[model samples]
Target: MTGQEAEELLREGALTVEGRIPDASNAVLYCSVSHQERSAHCVYKPVEGERPLWDFPDGNLARREVAAYEVSRATGWGLVPPTVLRDGPLGEGMVQLWIEPGHHSDQDDEGDGALLALVEDEEPGPGWKAVGFAQVGPGRTALLVHADDQRLRRLAVLDAVINNGDRKGGHLLTAPQSRLYAIDHGVSFHTENKLRTLLWGWAGEELPEEAVRVLRHLERDLSGDGELAVRLAELLTAPEVDAVRARVAELLRSGRHPVPSGDWPAVPWPPI
Candidate 1:
């Protein structure tokens, strides 16, 4: 379905809580949403149910989720699923269309094998770059893995621009036709330098030509009176939106993947 259609359904649909996502830090409900003839399975995070963080202000996570979608669209990558801010059964919140994984063709069989195998190994093989190690046992038993997909590389750039602070492994969803979707962006767009992610595999590498082109387009769009800048102002603080513009400019100047900062944790906990 088109993004506009999906967004409309998300905005207007009647939501019924189906279940809760186990082990999620905050309350996340799996909901069945229906709007007239259109029906969709979605995830809803009510603002009233959020677990407050020390850094982020209270009750703004839902807006941040929607703002992340706006940045995704402005970048022209469509990396984030269609998301909208609306009132749900619980309260005001963010609603996003659910994407199911493992619906690929034979062409993706090889890549799937690589991904599954890498998850179990202690080191990444060729065509992959190890980002961090995950402790699976008590004594130095860490599992090493990497993300080798080009789409994820693009998403890394997106996370950088948005200052995403909690890009956990489970937030990356796989959809049909080998498409990857980034979710759980409630902690994004902070004015502080808080880009925690596991997508540092391409650090120090030159940005691909396609990424450069998209960054240039986004930089232009975020300029004064542009659609992206205007939309962001409605969802984020002035300083937060300005920080996004600054990130874009810095990315364009560097023309390469950003190195990890020593001040913050480069990888999120429970690296997928």
Candidate 2:
């Protein structure tokens, strides 16, 4: 389905909870949303079910999730799934179109081996970029690596722009057609520098030409009185929204991907 149609179903459809997603920190409900004859699977995250984070404000993660979708939409990369914020069976929450696994699940090593790997060798080899060294077992260390694929590179840029704090490996989803989708964006759009991800392979590298062009467009769209700027003001705090613009400007000025600030851990825990 098209993004617009999926969004419409997510926003206006009747959501029937199918089950709960296991092992998630917050409540993640697997459901099917239907509007008349059209129906699709979706994930719902209610605001009331959110766990308190010392760093982020309470009860706003749902909005942030929607906000992330907005920014993703603006980028024209469609890196994030079609998402919306509306009332759900639990309460007000973030609803997103469910992405069916393509040939592999998120942790399917057989398929995603090229996208991410723990290499015995020190270097990442050709077509791969080293994230950093990781401790795999007792006294055994391996180099954490990710593919140099353009899709992940674009997502890395999006992560930087949103100040994404938790870009875990499990958060990366592959759709039926091999489309890449990044979910769990509740910790994004922070006023502070909170970018954390495994896709740091391109750190300090020059921005791709396409990414530069997209950033330029974002810089314009996020400026004063712009549609995106106005929309974000509703979903995030004024300072947080301003910080997004600042981040875009910084990316444009540097013309290179961002490096970790070293104030916090560069990669999320359980980096797989």
Candidate 3:
């Protein structure tokens, strides 16, 4: 079916908004049965006429985000699983797996103090590890679900190269066991545009071998009829996939170890 038909399907659901939330776009808590055999956590977005209070220009914002998440899912990366996009009674919507909030240290807060922390960069540790305040729990508190901070750190760097422009601390979630996950990727890989993000601090350094392998595979798959391109096409335009291929090629050719330089946007920026 065409995009319009798909959206029509979403609009037929018995979806309702739970409330408005800050940070994220107009997306709000919504409930509706998803699969015939199961239910899921979902969010709905309405046209501006329906939800003038919501800042998103249209349901396309939700579409952009869901597309980016699919890119990660295509790579077998666990940042976000593929989410179901559909039409709701109110408007277009999505039904996705819900993530429970992890425990936070005393510093984590949800108010203005928390938002301020995101733009305010501070060294979380030595070795160039700067963390966004979102990582800080309520009132600048830290979360206890401590996955390998280093791995998450590396993933953040890759996120930047991929031009994932929405890796805000709030988007990087961890389970109680410290399993890292990233969410909200509405703006990514715009095909030859500056897909720059908050993770630019590692621009001059050699990429981790582990990351390079992933890129290498992606590079090869882009030219063939494989899952990566098929999956990417679901979210990105044909040109966007070409752009991703170019970026991966450029990075792989550098043959350098990971390091930071002034040329990149900024290290430890909130959404790198």
Candidate 4:
């Protein structure tokens, strides 16, 4: 469903704005929760629309993002906060746990150092502010100052198997604590061109011990008899999951987790 639909469906106490809807976010919104749940400082995102150059259908990316996030979370990436595809005052909008440092939470311990490093990233260039946590690599002249080089690399390997395409820099978020979190899974899963990302350098390299642990866990869940695969089957097609498995098998076959070569579509265009 579209963001507006989300607004309308779950609009019990959802907030809205007169005209201050963010660019591209078609609807204006605010927090609807009464209790001190995850959305303590919730800010609503109305589905304005997508910009040019993507050519995707309306709200397709957002909807898929929520679904993929479910898959990712079930696979052991607790980075994403719980989200709901609910009906809001405007329409069907996806409400998620806000990431901002809030009253109950100080900062994610793992997030602080990482964010400090990103803010102090003069080694690459100026204005490379750590926007989000996905894959923020350097351009032809820029240095990829994304925090924890290996961490993102490992996630990318897992992402390839899952066929996550929109793991760009903006999709990754960093709280003041340095803990890295990924967002926006609307473009995940195996599609014709669902590999848009930045962390492709360690393609053939060994998946780290920490990462391997997570992979092993996910592998078990995707054992064709497990629930995650079954859930994906309901949300996605068998061929899509098969393609992802094929990519995973290829990565496992080759020992090298090589990095990116700055290729087309492999690295997101415009480098945002």
Candidate number with greatest lDDT = 2
What is the model-wide C-alpha lDDT for candidate 1?
0.83
Candidate 3 ranges beyond 4 A from true positions: 1-17, 32-34, 45-59, 103-128, 131-148, 192-196, 255-272
Summarize candidate 2's per-residue lDDT along 87-181 as a digit string, tens digits.
99999999999887453323432464457778899888998899999888999999988877888899999999999999988778765445778
The CA lDDT of each predicted structure is 0.83, 0.90, 0.50, 0.51
lDDT of 1 by residue, 23-42 (tens): 87788899999988999899
Over all chains combined, what TM-score does candidate 2 have?
0.96
Among the numbered candidates, top TM-score falls to 2
TM-score of each: 0.91, 0.96, 0.65, 0.64
Query: lDDT score, residue 30, model 1?
Result: 95
Please list the Cα RMSD from the true structure of every candidate, rounded to 1 decimal place: 2.8, 1.8, 7.8, 7.4
Can you write out model 4's per-residue Cα lDDT over 1-272, one digit (the tens) per residue?
33333323333444443343343324434464532221133334434443322644555444454556555576565556555565545556555555553211112345333322233333434322232233345632324544335446555665666666666555565554444566656556645536666555455557676665655666666677777667666555677666655655555555445344344356565444
Q: Candidate 3 on 1-272: residue-level lDDT in tens?
A: 23333333334434545555455444566454433333444544443313332323333545555665555554555566345566555545554445555522211223111211232333433333333235444566441121224445456545644566445545655554445556655555655333334443444656677777777776767767777677677755677677777777777888443343335443334332
Name the weakest run of 10 consecutive residues (lDDT summed) in model 1: 101-110
Ranking by TM-score: 2, 1, 3, 4
CA deviation > 4 Å runs, candidate 1: 101-111, 114-123, 138-143
